[model samples]
Target chain A: MTAETQVREPLTLKRVGRFVADNPLIPLVVLLLLLVGVLEFMRPGIVNERWIGNTIKFAIPLAMLAACQTMTMLTGGIDLSAAVAATISAFVMATQVPIVGVPLAICIGLLPAILMGLVNGFGVAVCRVHPLIMTLGTGLIATGCLQVYQRFVIASGSVVPDGLAWLGTGRTWGLPNSLLLFVPMAVLIIWAQRRTGFGRLLYALGSNETASRISGVRPWQVFLALYALSGLIAGVTGLLYVGLIKAPSLSLVNPLLLPSVAAAVIGGTSIFGGRGGYGGTILGALILTVLGTLLTLLQMPEGARRILFGLIILTVTTIYIRLTEQSR
Target chain B: MSRLITKHGWTAGLLSILVLLFILTRMIQPEFGASGLDSLSRATLPFAFATAAMAVVVIAGGIDLSVASMMAVAGVTAAVLMDGAGDGMTVVAVIVVLLIGLAMGAINGALIVLTRVPDIVVTLAMLYVWEGVALLILNAPGGAATPWLRQLIVGPFLVPWLPKSFVFLVVCVALIWVPLKRSKLGLSIYAIGSDELAAYRSGVAVGRTRIAAYAVCGLFAALGGLTLTLSTGNGEPIPGPYLMASVSAVVLGGVVLGGGKGAILGPIIAVIILRLVRMDLTLMSVDPNVTTIVEGTIMVVVVMFGGVIAYRGRQK
Candidate 1:
C-alpha cells in the first residue's frame, strides 16, 4: 500500500507538469485567476456578476481590435493604421447616420477602411515597402482625410444608431450583448487559424517567406486579402466601441492602438511572426482590462499611473518570455 | 563630374531638389530672404537634430521610439534647471542637460542588452516611462529658458545672414558625426548593423557598439530638446510631432530602415525639404489639415520609388 501510494503521487505530479507544458494558456489562466483573487481580497465583494459583465463588455472591443494585430503579427507585419481605420469608420458612421439611414451609413463608413487596407496591402506586397512605414503613412493620410471630412460635416449633428447601442451596451443572462457579436467573431478567427488553408498559408509565409514563395504561395494575393480583412475587422471594432462609449470623435479609437499591440504581444504572439492564436489574445485583453481596473482603484496620479503601467508591462512580458522559453 | 555624381549621386540629387523647392518657396513668399532663411534655420534646427538622432540609431540597425520622449524629458529638465539662472549657471545647466540625455540613452541601451529584449519593445516601454518622468518633473508647461541661452541658440551669429543655429548644426556635423564616421567604432557600427553574426565572428564588439550608437542618438535628441526650449522660450512636457517627422526624414534622406546603409547628411537635407514643404503649404493658404495629407502622400510616393529602384536592382 505504501509503495503504491508513492508511485501514484509521482505519476500525478508528472501528469500536471505535462499538462502545463502542453497548454500555454494554462499559465495565463492561472495568472488571471491570481489577479482576480488579489482584487477581490483588496476590495471585498467587488468581483460581483455585474462587475464581471462590465469587464467583459469593455474587453470585447479591445479583443476585436487586437484581432487585427494577431492576424497581422502572424504574417510578421503590424497594422499601425488599425486605430485610424476604426476611428474613421466610427466617425463616418455616426455623422452619416444624421444625413443617411443607418444601414447605408454603415456601408459607406466601412468603405474608407477597406480602401485604406487595400492600399496598405499593395504597398507591402507589391511595392515591397516595409509594413511599419506603409501603415504609418496610410494612418497619417487617413487622419488628415478624417479631419478634412470633419470640417465638411461639422454642421451636421451626429448620433449613435439605436441598434448599435443595444448591441454595444445591452446584456442577456448576465452576459454582455457584445458577446453576441464577439463569440461568432472569435470562433471564426480561431477556426481560421487552425482549420483553413489560408490560415496555414499565413503561418507558412510568416515563418519563411522565401520558402513559401518557392512553394507557389502567391504572397501578393494573400497579403492583399489579409490586410483587407483586417481593415473590415477594425471597422467593426470601431462600430462596437462607438456604441459602447455612446459617442464618436475624430480620435475615437486612437488610444487603443498601443494597447491592442500590447495585448497581442502579451498573448505570446511573436512580433517576428508565425506563432500565436486569437484565444490567447482574448485572454490578454481581459487581463489588461483587469489590470487597468486595479490601477484605477489605486487612486494614483496620472504620471505615477503611467509609470507603473509601463513598468508592469515590461516586467510581465519579461517574466512570461522567460517561463515560456524554459518550458520549451 | 560623372565620377563625382556616381560617388555622391544621392547628395547631388537631394541638393538639386532642395534648390528647386527653395526657389518655389521664394516665389510663393516674396518676403523669403536672408531673414527668412534665419527663421527657417531656427525652425529647422530642433527637427534637424531630432532627425539626426533617429538617423544614427537606424544606421546602427535599431529604432528608438523614445527619441521624442527623450527630447521632452531633456527640454523640461533644462527648463527646470535653467529657469531664472545666471549666464554661468545656464551654461552649466546646458552641459548637465546634455549629460542627462546621454545617460538616458545609455540606460536604454543597457536595459536592452541586459534584458535580452527586442529593441522595439524596450524602447516602446521606455517611451512611456520617460514621458511620465517629464510630466512628473513639470506638471504643466510654464518653465522659462534663460535669455542668454535662448539668444545664443536661436539668435544670429557674427554675421547677420548666418544664423547661430545653422553654425551649430555645421559644427556638430563636422565635430561629432564626421569624427565618428571616420573612427573604428563607427565602422564597427556599420559592420554589425549590416551583419551582426559576421561582425561578431570578425571580432567586433556588437553590444558595446550598439550601446554607443544609442548614446550618440540620445545626445542629439537632447540637443533637439534644447533647441526646442530656446526657440519657444518655455519648457514643454509634452512631445511634439517629432517622432513621425524624424522617422520620415530619416527614410526620406535615404537611410535604409533595416539599417547599415545610409548617411547622416541625407536625413538633415530631408528635414530641410520637409520643413520647406510645410512652409510652402502655409504660404499657398492651403487648409492646415490638407498639409498632413500631402505629407503622407509624399512619404508614400518616395518610399514606393525607393522600393521600385531596389527591386530593379535586385532583379539585375
Candidate 2:
C-alpha cells in the first residue's frame, strides 16, 4: 500500500506539471487568486464586490495601453511613444472640449497620435531605423510639441466631458462601467490575433523577418499598420484615463509607459517577439493592479515599494520563463 | 594617407561638424571669451564622461539602462561622504565611490549572466532598483562638496580656457581608454560583441569580458558623478536629462545600435556638438521647449542618413 501510494504521488505530480506547461494562464490565474486571498487575509473583508469593481476600473486603462505593447512586441518592436501619445490625446481633448465641444475635440486629439504613429512607421519601415530609437525620438518630439501647444492653450481651460466621466467611473450591478468599452475591445483584439491574416503576419515577421519577406510579405505595410493601430489604442486609453482621473496635465499618462511594458512582459509576451497574446496581457494588468493595492496597504516607503516591485517582476519573469522553456 | 582617411572617415566627418558648430556658435556670440570656453568645458564634462561610459558598454554589445542611476547613486554617496571632509578624506571618498560603482556594474553583469534573461530586461529591472536605492539614500536634493575638492576637479588648471575638468578628461582618456583599446581584453570585447558564439569558440572569456566591460562602464559613470558633484558643489539625487542625451550622443557618434563597432572619440565629439547646439539655440532665443523637438528631429535625420549609407554599402 505504501509503494502504491508513492507511485500515485509521482504520477500526480507529473500530471500537474504537464497541465501547467500546456496552459500558461493557469499559473497566472492562480497567482492572482493567491494575491487576492492575501489581501483578504491582511485587511479582513477587503476583497468584496466593490473592491473588485474598483480594481477592474483602474486596470482597464492600463490593459488598453499594454495592448499596444503586446502587439508591437509581437513584431519584435515596442512603442516607447505610447505614453506620450496617450498624454497628448488626453491633454488636447480636455483643453479642446471647452472650445469645440466633445466630438470634434476628441477627433482632433486622436489626430496627433495617428500622426506620431505614421512617423514611427515611416522611420521603421522606410528608413529602417531601429524601433527603439525611432519610438524614443518620436516620444521626445511629441512631448516637446505638447509643451509648445500648452503655451497656446493655457487660456482655453480644460474640462472633462460628462459622458466620459460616466463611462470612466460609473458602475452597474457591481461591475465597472469601463468594462462596457474594455470587453468589446479585448474580444476584438483577441479574435484578430488568432483569426486574422495581419495577426499571422506579425508573428511571421517577428519569428523570421527575412523568411517572411522572401515568402512575399510586404514588411513595410505591416509595420506601418501595426504602429498606427498601436497609436489609436494609445489615444483611446488616454481619453479613458483622463476621464478616470478627471484632470488633465502635460504629463498625465506618462507614468504608465514603463508599467504597460512591464504588464505586457509579465503577461508572457516575449520582448524578442512572436510568442504572446492579449489575454495574457489582460491578466498581467490585473495582477499589477492587485500588486499595487497590496503595496499601498502595506504602507511602505516609496523607495521600498519600488525596490519590491522591481524584485517581484524579476522573480516572476524568471519563473515564468523557466516554466515555458520546459514546455518547449 | 588615403587608407587612413577611408578607415577613419566617420571620425573626420564628426570632427569637421564639431568645428563648424563651434565656428557658428562663435559667430553668434562674438565675445566667446575665455570664460565662455571655461563654462563650455564645465558644462560638457559630466555628459562627456557619461557618453563615454555608455559607448564602452555599447561597443561590448550590451546596453546598461541603469547608467544614469549609477551616476546618481555614486554622486549622492560621494556627496554624503565628502561633505566637509579634509582633502585626504575627500580623495579616499572618491576612490571608494568609484569602487562602489565598479561593484554595482559587476552585479548588473552577474545578474544578466545568472538569470539567463535578456540584457534589456535585467538592466531595466536594475534601473528601477538602483534608482530606488538613490532615492532611499537622499530623498531630497542636498549634499555638499568641499571648496578645495571642487577647485581641484573643476577649477582652471593653468589657463582660463583649459579648465582642470578638460585636463582631467584628457588624462582619463589617455590613461584608461587608450590602454584598454590596445589590450587583449579590448580585442575580446570587440570579438564578443560582433559574434558571441564565435568569440567563445575561439577561446575568448566571453562572460568575464562582459563583466569587465560593465565594470569599466561603471567606473566612468562614477567619474561623471564626481564631475557633477564638483561642478555644482552640491550633489542632486536627480540624474536629470543626461540619460537620453548620452544615448543620442552614442548613436550620433556612429556606434551601431546592435553593437560591435564604434570609437569613443566620436561620441565625445558628438556630446560637444550636442551641447553647442543647445547653446546656439539659447543664443538665438528660441523657446527652450523647441530644443527638445530639434534634438529629436536631429536624431531621426542622422539615423536615417546612416541607414541610407549602410544600404548603399550593402548594395555595393
Candidate 3:
C-alpha cells in the first residue's frame, strides 16, 4: 500500500509542475498588456511621454506596498494594519517636517510605524494571539491615533514644508521621486526573499510554523523581524501617500488595507501562507491600477465600481487558490 | 470574585460603567436621573440583542461580518412584504424575517464549507454583495416601521415598564445560552476552532459544526438588523456598513479570537457598557469620536490584558 502511494505521488507532482510552468503569469500579464495596447492604440497622443511616465510612476508605490505586504503574508499571517500604520507615520512625519527638518522628521516619523509593528509582532508571536485579531486590535488603535492627530495636531493648520512635499510631487528626469525609491526597494526585496536566510525562514515558518521550529528556526524572531520590515515599508508608503495627496485624510489609509491583501493574494501568494513570489504582486498591482483607471475613464458610479472591485478580488483569489491546489 | 470576574468580564465591566455614568449624569444633568436610566434601557435593547446574536458565532469560532448587511436585507424584505398590509401582518412579517435570516445563514455556511475560503474573506466579500443586492431591491428607505412592528419589539411585557425587545433579548439568552453550553454541537465548535484535525479524529463532525456556527452567526446578525429597523423605523444602506463594529463589540466582551471561550452574557453586557460609555461621554462634553477611540483602545487593551491574566492564572 505504501509503495503504491509513493509511486503515484511523483507522477501527480510532475503534472502539477508542468501545468504551472505552461500558464504562470499568462492571464495577468496578458490582461495588462492588452490594456496597455488598447490605451496606447486608442489615444497615442494622450498615452504619450508624460502619461506613460505617470502610469509607471503610480504603479511603483502600488507595487512596493503590495510587495511589502506579501513578505509578511508569506509567513502564514497578514498585517492588516499596514495602510493605517503608514498613515499615522506619514502624518507624524509630515507634521514634524517643517519643525524638525525633513531628514530628521523622516527618521522620527519612521519610529511610530516600527513601534506599532513591534507591538503587533509581540502580541502575535510571543503571546500566541492570532495574527488577524492582534493586528486588527492595533490597527484600530493606530487609526484612532491618526484621527486624534488629524483633529488636534495636524489639522491645527500645520503645513509640511514645501521642499518636502516636492519629494513626493517633484520629478527626477520627469519621473516621481516616490516611484524612483520604489525600484531599488523592490529589487532588494526580491533578492532577499530568494536568497537570504531570514527570507527563506519566513517561507519555512509560513509553510509550517511547527516544523520550522522543530528544525531549530526561531519563529518569534522571524515574525518580529518580518513585522519590522512591514512597518518600514508602510512608513515609506505613508510618506509617499502624503506627498502625492497634499492633505492627510483618514479615507486614504482606510481603503488601501484590503487592496494590499488582494494584490498580494492575486499575485499568487497563498492566503493560506507560503509558496508565492513578489513578481506576481507587481502584476496584481498593475492589474488593479489599470482597473481603477478604466473605471474612471468609463465613468462608472461608485457603487458599481465597488461591486466590480469586490467581485474581481473574490474571483481572482478563488481562481489562484484553485490553480495552486491543482498544481499541488 | 476572581472566578466571577473572569466569567463575567463583560458583565462586571458593563455594570461598573453604568453605575459611573449614572452618578456623573445625576451630579451634572440632574434631569437625567431615573428617566435617563429608562431611556438608556430602551435605547440599548436592540444592540444587546445584536451582540447576543454576534456571540453565538464567536463562541463557535467564526465571523459573520456580513450580518449587518444581512439584517438590512431582511429588514427591507420584511418591510416591503408587510408594507401597507398593516397591523394584522406584523406577526407573519416577524416570522418571515427570522426565516430569511436563517436562510442567509444557511447559504453563508454552505458557501464557506464548499469554497474553503477564509470566513473573514468570504464574509467580508458577502458584506458588499448582500448590501448591493439589498440596494437593488428598494434603492431607498420609505416604509413606515408599522405600529405593530414597533409594539412587537418596544411594547411592555410583564413588568409593564420593561421594553419587549429587552425581554426578547433575555429570552433568546435563556433559550440559547445554557443548552449551547451543554450540547454536543457547542462543545464540538470549541474543539474545531482549537484544532480541526484532532476534533475530526475525536469523532466530532467538524464541518457540520462549523457550518452551523456560521449559520447561527448569520441568523443572529439578521435578528439584530431587524430589531434595529423596528427601533429606527428606517432601512438605509448607510447603517448596515457601519455595523461591522458590532462584531468587534462581541470580541471586546471576552470572546477570544480564533474562538472557544465566551458567553452570551459577556457580549450582552459589552453592548450595554459600550452604549453607556458613549452616553456618558456626551454628558462629559467630549466629542462623540472619543467613543470610537475609547472603544477601540479598550478592545485592544482588554484582549491583550486578558491573555496576560489568563497566562498568570495558569502559572499559579
Candidate 4:
C-alpha cells in the first residue's frame, strides 16, 4: 500500500473529531441542556442566582469526592471508604474545631481519610489483597469508628460551633466558599492529570500493570500513591461537608457512597480501570446534580427518583460501552 | 483431594463460626435460647435466598448489586397488584411478580451482553432504575395481601412442630445445587467465568450463559422479595435501597469476588452466621451499630485469609 493510504487507514484527526462528535455523552449533554431550559421555562425563577448557587454549593463536596473516586477507579480499583472517611473527617472537624480552629481542624479532618487511603493502598498494593474486599473491610471499620467516636464525644442533635460555620455555610461574592474552593481543586487535579509524569504512570499502571512493571515502572508505588490520593481527596471533601452543614451526622455518609461511584462510572471512566479523563467526570457530576434537581421538581417520590437515578447511570454506562466498542 | 479440601476450607471455617456464635448467644442470654434462635433463623432465611440469588451472578464473573432493589421492585409490584386484584387472581399475581423480576434481569443481561459494560456498573445502574420504578408505583410503603396466598407461602408450614421456612430454604438450596452441579449449564457458568474468551472461542455460548445466570439471579431475588412480603405481611418500600449489602454476605461466604470459584452452600452458611452474629451481639449487650462493624470486620478477615489460602494452593 502507498504510504498515504496506510496512514489514512488508521484513525486520523478527522476520524477522531468525528468520533467525539458522535459520542453518546454529547447527545446526553445536549439533552441535559434542553431539560434545564425547559425547567427554566416552566419556572422562570428556577435558574436564579441564589438557587443556582445553592445547587453548586450542595454538589461541590460530592463532585470533589467523585473526582477522587474517578482517579482510583481509573486505576482499576475503588474507594469504598470515601463516605466513611468523609464521615470520620466530618466528625473530627466538628469535635476538634473548638480546640484547633477551623484551618487546623480542616487539616486534621483530612488525616483520617489519608490514613484510610494508606491502609487501602498498603493492603491492595503491598499485601496484594483484592481492592474490593480490602476496601470493604476498611470502609466498614472506618464507618464503625465514626459511629463510635460520634456517640462518645459529640452531643446528639447539636451543631459544634457557630464560628466554624463560615467554612461551609459562608457566602463570598454571591457564591458558596466551598464552591469557590472546588474551583482551584478541580483546576489543580486537571493539571496534574494532564501535565505530570505521575499521571502518565497512573495510566500506564492501570492499562497494564505487568507491562508497566517490566518497563521499570514501580506499579506498587503508583498504586499506593493513587489510593492515598483518593483518600486524601475524600478527606478534603469531608471537611468541606462539615463546613456546609456545620454538624456531624453519620447518616450523611450513607447516601453519598453509591452516587459518587455512579458519578465516576457515568463520567466515562472504565470500571475495568484505565482510559478516562477527569473532564468527563466533572460533566458527569453536573449531570447527576441536574438529574436530582429535575426529579425533585417533577415531584417524584424519593423511591422513584432513586430508581431513575440508577437507571440513568445504567443507560449512560451501557451507551458509553457500545459507542466505544463501535469506535474500536 | 487436598487441593479441593484447602480450597473449600473457608466454607468450613465460616460454618464453625456460625455454630460457635449460636452457642455463645445461648450462653450469654438463656432467655434467647429458643426464641432468639427462631428469630435469627427467620432473619437468616430471606438473606440466604438473596445471597444465593446473587451468588449465581458472581459465579458467572458478574455481580448483581441490584438484587435487593429488584426484590424491592418485585415486592412492591406484587403487593400493589395483589392489592388491586381480587382474591381469585392471587396465583396469577405471584406469577406476574416473578415475571417482572425475570424481565428486569433480562434487561440487565441484554444491556451487559449487548453493550459489554462492566457488570458492576451496569448492575449498579439497574439498582437505581428498579428503585425508581418501585417508588413510582408505590408513593409510600403500603401493600395488601391475599390471605390464602400469604398463608400458603409466608405462614409457617409445620414439619412436626418445626417452622417449614427452614425446610423450604433447604429444599431451594437442594434444587439449585443438584442442577447446577450435575448439569451442563452449571459447568458452562464456571467455564465462562474462569475464562470468558477461552469459553467463547471454544463455542460454549458465553453470552447465553451470562444472560441465563442473570435471569436466575433475578428469579431468586424475586423469590426472596415475595417470601419477605409474606413472612412480614407488610409491603414496605424501604428495603430496596438497603438490600445491596447482602451481596457482600454472599462474598463473605467464601465466594471469590471475580467468580469462577466458590459454592452456594458457602453463602448459605455465611447468611446463617451473619444472623447468628447479630443475635449474639444483642445477647452480649452490644449496640446495634456495632453489628455492622463486626460483620464488615469478619468479612475482611475471612476474605483475606481465603485469598492467602487460595494463592498458596495455586502455587502448589
Candidate 5:
C-alpha cells in the first residue's frame, strides 16, 4: 500500500525471480530435499545409504524415458510410442540374448527401436501428421509387431542369464550399477540440449516454425532427427528396463508412458516447447521415485498414488505456467 | 444432397466405408445376417457415444483424454449405486451418473480455465485422477445394473429389431449436433479452433465456451459409459481398451486432432467400421492380432489422407 514498502518488496521478489530463472532446478531440488527430510523424520529409516541407492536405481529407467520425452517435447512434438519402442527393444534383447552375446544382442535389439523412431519421425516430419497421432500409430504398430513376433518367431524363452544380475540389481562401490548409464546419459542429454546445433534447431522450431523456416531451417530434417533421437533414447531406456525388471512382458512399458511425460512437464519443460533442460527433469524423476517410495511406505493404495501423480503434474504445470506467464 | 456431401466429405466417406464394409462382411459370412448387423450396431453403440463426446471437445479446439476414465466412473457409479435398488431407482441412478459425469467434466474445464494450462495436459491429468477414483470405487470390477435399465436403453424403443440403442444414438446426435451446429456458440467453437486469438478478439467467450464444450462432452461420455454398463451387465472399473478405441474411432471419422472440423455422424460410422473390421475378421477366421495393426494403420492413413486433401486444395 505504501510506495517505499511496495518498491522494496518487489525488489526482493525480483531477486528471487532472477535466481529461480537462472536455475530452475533449484526449486525442484529444494522440494526433493524437503521431501526427503520429512520422510526421514517420519520413518527415520528412509535416508539410509542402501535405500537411497536403490531409489536412484529405480529412477534410472524413468529418468532415461524422461530424457526421451523431454527431447521430443522440446521440439513441440511428443513420442507416445517411446515406451512401446523400448518394449520392442527389450523383446528383441530378451529373445536374442541367448543366441547372440549380450553386446551383439543389444545392438540387434536397438534396431527395431530405431526403425520405429524413424517411422514416427517420418510420419511427423515428412507427412506433416500431428505428433500425437503419429506416435500413437507407431505405438500400436509396435504392440502389434510384438504380438505377431511372439505368435510366430519365438514363442518360448526370455530367461535372463545370471550373469546380467550384477548389472541389473547389483551394486558397486556402495552405489547402483545403473547409475553409470543414468549419470552420463543425463549429462550428455543436457549438453546436447544446450550446446548442440540440433538442440538449437529444436528450440527454434518449437518457438516459431514459420520463422525458423524463413531462416533456412529445414523443419523436416530437424524433426526427423529429433524424433529419431527420442526413439533411440527410448530403446536405450528399454534395454535399461531389462536390467531392472529382469524379463520382458508386453505390459512392462505401459505404466512408464504417462510418467515419462509427467516427469518432463513437472521438471519445468514447457509442453508448448522451446524451453526446458535435463537438470530439472532429473529432480522430477527423483521426486516421483521418492513419492512412490513414501506412498508405498505409508501403505497407500496404488490408485491413490496414481492420482497423486496426476495432481502433481497438474500442480507443477500450473506453477510453471504462472511463473513463465508472469515473467513474459 | 450434393452440397451436403461436399460440406461433410468426411461423413460421406465414412458412410461409404461403413456401407461397403457391412455388405462385404455380411457376404463373407452369410450366417451374419440381419442379426449380425443388429449385433454390430449394438457393439458399436458405446464407442459411437464416446466418439460423439470426443467430437464435441475436439470441435471446440480442445482435446479430452479422460474419456475412458469418465466412462468407467459413470458405469461404476451407476452399477454400484443401482445394484440393490428397485426398478424405480434406475432413473435416479441414470440421472446421478450423468450429473457425476458433467461435474467431472466441469472440474476439468475449471482447472483449465482458472489455471490456463493446456487442455491436453489438464485432460491427461484428469484421465489419471479419474482412473484412480474409478479403481478406488470398485477395485475388482463387480457391480450390477438392473435388467430393466439395460432393457430401457438396448431394448425396443419404436420398431422391433430396429434396436432402441440405434434410435437413441440418432436422437442423441440430432439433439446435440443439430442444435450445437446451428448455435452462435457452435460457430465460435470452430472459430476458436481455427484461430483462438481472432475468436477472442471478435468477442467470443473463449473460457465459457470451452467449459461448455467439456461439460457437454461429459454428458455424452457418461451416456457412453451407461451404454457400456448396460451391455456388459456389470461395471468395469478399469478403463480397458475403450480409450484407444474411442480415439481411433474419432480420428478415423476424420475429426482433426487439432480440432475445428468433422461431424458426429462421421465418428459414429467410423465406430461401426472399426467394430465391423473386428467382426469381419472374427467371422473369416483371420488372426485377431492384426486388428491392432489395422486400427493403427487406419489412423495413420486417415490423417495422411486429410493432409493430402489439404495439399490438393492448396495447389488449387
Candidate 6:
C-alpha cells in the first residue's frame, strides 16, 4: 500500500484536514447534506419529514444489504454471491407462500441463503479459495438452482403475497415498518462488533489470518459465522424487497449489490478488511439512496446513472483509503 | 526439471482434470468425435479466449470485472465502425477495437496504481464505465462485423478440421505465454503479486509490470470480442456472462486469484473442461440452468480442494 504525502500545513489546518479524512463517514455526511439541500432547492418541500421517511423506506433494503457486505469485508473477504442469495431467498419466499403459508415459507426461503453462505465461507476459509471466485461460483450455483427450482417446482409470479407486505412496506406512526426491522438489526450488528468477542475475532481474522490461525482463533469458524450472518441479512433484505416491490424477481436485488458494497466502503470499511463500522455504512447507504433519488429526479438514463454511481464509489473509496490509510 | 514440474502442483492437477474431462467427453459423445469437434471448439472459442484474458489479470494480483464488457465494447465498436465502411476499413476497424480494449485496460491499471485503491474497487468501477460506454456507443446492439473479419477468427488459413479457437490458444501459448512466463518481467509480475512491498524492495518495477499485465489482458479481451462478433456476425451489449464464466473457470483451473501462482495452461484446459461439462449436460436434455449449477459446484469444489492443498503445502 502507498501512503500519499502532502506538503506541510499549519497546525490547525492540518488537524482539521486529518480529522475529516480520518472519519470515512464525515465526508459522506457532508455529501448527504449537500444532496438533501439541493433536492429541497430543486423541488420545494421535497426534503420534508415525508421525504425523509420515504428515503428511509427506499434505503432500508439497501442498508440491510450493505450491512451484509460490511460483515464480509470486515473479514478481508467479500460475498459476490450476496445479490444471488437475496434473489434466491426472495424467489423461494414468493413461490412457497402459497403452499407452506407465509411464516413457514419465509423460514424455508432463508435456508438456501444460509447454505450458500456456508459454502462461500468453507471455500474461503477451509478451501483457501479466493473470495472473489468462491462467492462468484456460489452465486452462479444459487442462480442455477433457482432457475431449476422455478422450472421444476412453481413459477414465481410478480405479486408478493398480501401477508408479506406489512413487514416490507407497512407504516407505523408515520414510520415505515421496515424501519423497525432496520433499527434493531443495526443496533444488534453494532453491539455485536463493539461488545462481542466474535466481532473482535472477525477483525483479527482479517488483520492477519495466519497469525490468528496460530493464535488459536479458529478462522474457519469465524468465517462460517460471519458469512452465515451475511446470508441471513441478505435474506432479510430479499424478503423486504419482495414486500416493497410487491413482486419478486431473481434480479430484484441484483442492483443493490454494488450499492451495498459501495455504501459500506464509503462509510470507511476497508476492502482489505477490519477497520470500519456500521455507522459509516448506514451513512453510506443513505448517501447512495439520496444520490439515487437525485439521479432519478434529474431523469438520468440508466447508463448515466451507472456511470455516476461508479464514479462516486471510486472517488469516495479512494479518498477514504488514502486519508485513513496514511495514518494507520 | 522434475522438481520444477512438481512445483506447479496446481497446474499438474489441472492437466489431469483436463485429461479426465476429455476422456469422459469422448466416451459420452462418441458422435462428437472428429466431425463434431469443430463446432464444439467454435462454441467454446469466445469463453476460452475470455478465460485466458481474465487469468492474466488474476495472476497479476488484480481483478477485472469488466472483461465481458470490454469484449462487448470491442465487438459492437467493430460492427458499428465497419458496418458500411469503404475499402480496407476492415483492418482499421479491427485495430481500432483492439486499441479500445488496450486503452480500457490501461485505465483500469492506471486507476489502480495512481489512486492506491484496491484493484477490485478500481476495476469494479471500470466495469460499469466500460459497460456504460458500450451502451453509449451502440445502445441497442444492431451492427454486423465485417465478413472477412469473422472468417479471420476461424482462420481459413488453418486446416479444415481445426477450429480457429484451438489455433488461437496454440498461438498464444507459443507466442505470448511461453515467452512471457520465462521473461524477467514475468518474474517481476509474480513477485509483485506475491508481496508488493517485498517485490518493490527487490527492485521490481511493480507498477509498470502490473499495467503491462492489464494491457495484455485487454488485448486478449479485444480478441475475445472480435471472436464473438465473428462467431455471431452481430454484436450484443450485455456480454458479461463470460466474465463470470471466466472467473469460475479460473478457479476451476486452480489459479490462485490474487496472483503469483498457477500456470497459463491451467485456465486454458479448465475452459475445455467446463465446455465439456456443459456439452454433457445439454446432451442429457438437462435444463441449461443445470450446467450453470454444475459449473458453480465444480468451482466450489475446486476452491475447497485448493484450501486443503494450501494447508498441506504450508505444513510442508
The candidate maximizing lDDT is 1
Across the candidates, what are chain A's individual TM-scores? Answer: 0.94, 0.95, 0.87, 0.87, 0.94, 0.92
DockQ of each: 0.65, 0.70, 0.39, 0.58, 0.70, 0.69
Residues B235-298 of candidate 6: C-alpha lDDT, one tens digit per residue: 7877658988888777777678778877667787888888878887887778898888888888
Question: Once superposed on the true structure, which residue ranges of model 4 sit more than 4 Å away at CA?
Answer: A1-18, A21-32, A98-104, A154-164, A301-304, B1-7, B30-34, B81-88, B145-162, B240-244, B312-316
Model 3 per-residue lDDT tens digits across residues B170-203: 7766776578768888889788777778888999
Q: Write the per-residue lDDT of candidate 4 for residues B1-316, one digit (tens) a residue.
A: 9897777777878778877876777688776544454556567666888888888888898887788878888888778878856766878888898888778888888878987788888887887787777777776778877777665533345543345567678887788667876788898988887889998898899999999889878877887887777767757665542353566677787777788888898888888887778777867889877887887777777666666666687769
Rank by lDDT (best first): 1, 2, 5, 6, 4, 3
Q: What would the per-residue lDDT of candidate 5 be over residues A1-328, giving only the tens digit for each residue? A: 5999989987766677667777788888888998798889889876989888888988888888988888888878888999999998888888877677677888888998999888888888877888888898889877987888877646557755454556668899879888777778788888887999888888999889989999999998988888888889999888878777986887677798888888888898888888887888888889888877776777778678768868877987787667655533
Question: Tens digits of per-residue lDDT for model 3 on A1-328?
Answer: 9999999997777676557645657667976788777766655655666776677766666776776678877887888778877888778877776677778888888898898889888877777666776777787777767776667664345456566477667777877776667778888888999999988998899899889999999888888888888878888888787777788666665667767777777788876677787888888888877766765665655556656766666676666566556655
- Which candidate do you rate higher for DockQ, 1 or 4? 1
True contacts kept of 2: 0.58
Clash totals for all models, in order? 0, 0, 0, 6, 0, 1
What is the per-residue lDDT of model 1 for residues A1-328, given as tens digits with 9 covering 90 to 100? Answer: 9999999986776666556546868877887888899899889999999999999999999999999999999999999999999999999999999899999999999999999899999998999898888898999999999999999999997999999999999998999999999999999999999999999999999999999999999999999999999999999999999999998999999989878887887787777888888988998898889988988888877677777777776776776666555544
My TM-score estimates for the predictions, one after another, are 0.95, 0.96, 0.83, 0.89, 0.96, 0.94
The DockQ value obtained for model 2 is 0.70
Better of 1 and 6 by DockQ: 6
Candidate 4 lDDT tens digits, A1-328: 6988878966564475458545636745765687678778867878888877777787777788898778887778888788888778877877777666766776877888899999888878766677876887888777777777778765433345554467577888888777567888889887888889888887777798878889998877888898888888888777777767765777666577888888777777877777776777777777788778888887867876786777777777776665566555
Question: Which segments of model 2 are wrong by more than 4 Å?
Answer: A1-21
Candidates 2 and 5, the one with greater lDDT = 2
Residue B235 shift from truth in candidate 2, angstroms: 2.6
Runs off by more than 4 Å, candidate 6:
A1-13, A155-159, A326-328, B4-9, B154-158, B172-174
